[model samples]
Target chain A: MIILGVDPGLTRCGVGVIEAGAYRRLSFIHVDVVRSDPKSPQDRRLLTIYDGLAAKLDEFAPDVVSIERVFAQENRNTVLGTAQAAGMAMLAAAQRNIPVALHTPTESKMAITGNGKAEKIQMERMVARILNLNTLPKPADAADALAIAICHALRPAGAIQGGEREEHLTAAQRQWAKAAQKASRGRTQGRAM
Target chain B: MIILGVDPGLTRCGVGVIEAGAYRRLSFIHVDVVRSDPKSPQDRRLLTIYDGLAAKLDEFAPDVVSIERVFAQENRNTVLGTAQAAGMAMLAAAQRNIPVALHTPTESKMAITGNGKAEKIQMERMVARILNLNTLPKPADAADALAIAICHALRPAGAIQGGEREEHLTAAQRQWAKAAQKASRGRTQGRAM
Candidate 1:
């Protein structure tokens, strides 16, 4: 199965594609970053991302797309931009009728490095090792994208088919799930106020 | 001059169009709300907003587009969704090369009701009075959209032309600007960490 992974951001979005063979073998296909100028208007910046991702989707034509699910971040503006960028990635995939799977940062880390709390450098090294690349991918975002792709490749069967309705989750996945649920509750309470 | 105002949201996005005629006379052109199902996947919901706003832009063909500037809301999920929806509106406008203007909620309230902290009902009443509508626009989102359009109509000259580079601002505007600056700073700091 072919897979595309996206690490979404307005300033610098990461896009990576990989082909998964039988018995969990993986081959790197492409890796790149989509960047928008900060000086441009917000709308123009977002359009750059939207158009860039759409073109990548057409070129790669992956069977499935996996993106990092957004979590509450310390920076409101950054998080907002990240969410919008993620939305654009999902839209591009959906427009092409590609199924999308969302994975948390911890889940990707665990899949790549066997540690949910693995550091960035560890994750990068593992991604390089798994893809059999001689060197690490330049720019952390690119490595992160590869990690997301690897996560989807190693996920339990039928995870992507379920579409946000996973029937089973590992202990680490359940922990992140609980955190997501709590965060959602906090949002509802905020609306009431 | 023709103007389009958007009140961006995930569940319900409001869109309003108005024509500013000679002698400052305002004529209502259109008003409606675009909705997306909450149960749908996040990508589909965003596409709904994107397609809906794209259709509105094509139909109205307004000279300029005005959208509500998002603030740091207590509800993270809602705010994230709102930001993505607003991005869609901006993308639609930018694709058509229409100049885009952003007005804060307080700014719109002050422009419509002469009070920065006006209640919803008061703002709705003033919007109806300003638009010469016998009945208030259905759904609070529609009314909010109208208020944004009116605010753009009566704003100081050259504001939209400046494109986020306004040289001068009122005290209230400066206050909001400061808050936005602080938020940006927080984002950069988060990125460093």
Candidate 2:
């Protein structure tokens, strides 16, 4: 299966493509989507991200697309940017009816580093080690996109092959996660105050 | 001075621009950079983001660009994507000789809502309140980009004016943050295990 991994951002996005099934053959496809002067006007910036992402989809077609799911609430600006990036990515995939898989940051990190909280240097080292590359991917973002692809490669076939794996988290699991998140938010607020 | 706030991502980047120091005129911009494959080949995807961002810059011509500083460590993949987006944005601004300011998530949140851990709804409400807008900006990211712009407007003139801001973070601060992060990682690892 050919899995496409995307590290979505409002300005610059990292994209990596990997073909796995037998031997894993991974390739670096693209990295960085830099938007300028977000201060100008809203419609124009949205149009820029939409058009740019569409062009990428047209250029590289894959069986499945994998993206990092964002769950951050601390930085309102960053969270919103990430959510928009995620939304735009989903929209692009939805437009083509392509199945998209969202992976938590932990999932990708654990899959690559065997440690959920592995530092960037460690992750990059692992990527280089697993891929047998002579050097690390420059600009850590590229390494991360590659790591997400690796995570998809390591998952069981059933978890990712048929597009059956892309369903939302189980209702109970979602509820639990949400509750935990709410609790966490309360704690953070208490601490801040 | 015109300050532009950008929420960058691979898909859609939310941008809001406002004129500061006078009547405080506000303008919003949203740019979309959608890639078909989040995991497209790196060169292709990078080009897409670069071109899209370049086009937006040409259109906006912002004097100062303010972006959210990423502090996400739990989601390695998300952080990587955000870093890439931020990198692209910085590079674009550098090319234009425009001053760039990076704000931590907390700073932006506090600036907007008077609360560092404010909820998304709270942030949206505050953005509307501060901007005196009838409603919140759509897609959350748009509101955030606008918030970044507003944050810049609120900063002391010496902090963000005259191309005085450095393009990157100081090494000492980065090391300190990373060291603290590493220590936190050990704690989280112990708990997870």
Between which residue pairs do clashes occur in model 1? none
Model 1 lDDT at residue A66: 91
Winner by lDDT: 1
TM-score of each: 0.85, 0.43
Segments in model 2 whose C-alpha atoms lie over 4 Å from true places: A23-37, A157-193, B1-193
Q: Which candidate number has the best DockQ?
A: 1
Candidate 2 residue-wise lDDT, A71-138, digit = tens: 55443445545555555565566667677776666667666765667798998898877766778876
lDDT at B162 for candidate 2? 27
Per-prediction TM-score, chain B alone: 0.82, 0.71
Encode model 1's per-residue lDDT on A22-113: one tens digit a residue.
99999998999999998788789888998999999899889999998775543454777787788889878877889888787776876676
The CA lDDT at A160 in model 1 is: 34
Cα displacement (angstroms), candidate 2, residue A79, comes to: 0.7
What's model 1's overall lDDT? Answer: 0.79
Classify candidate 1 by CAPRI docking class: acceptable
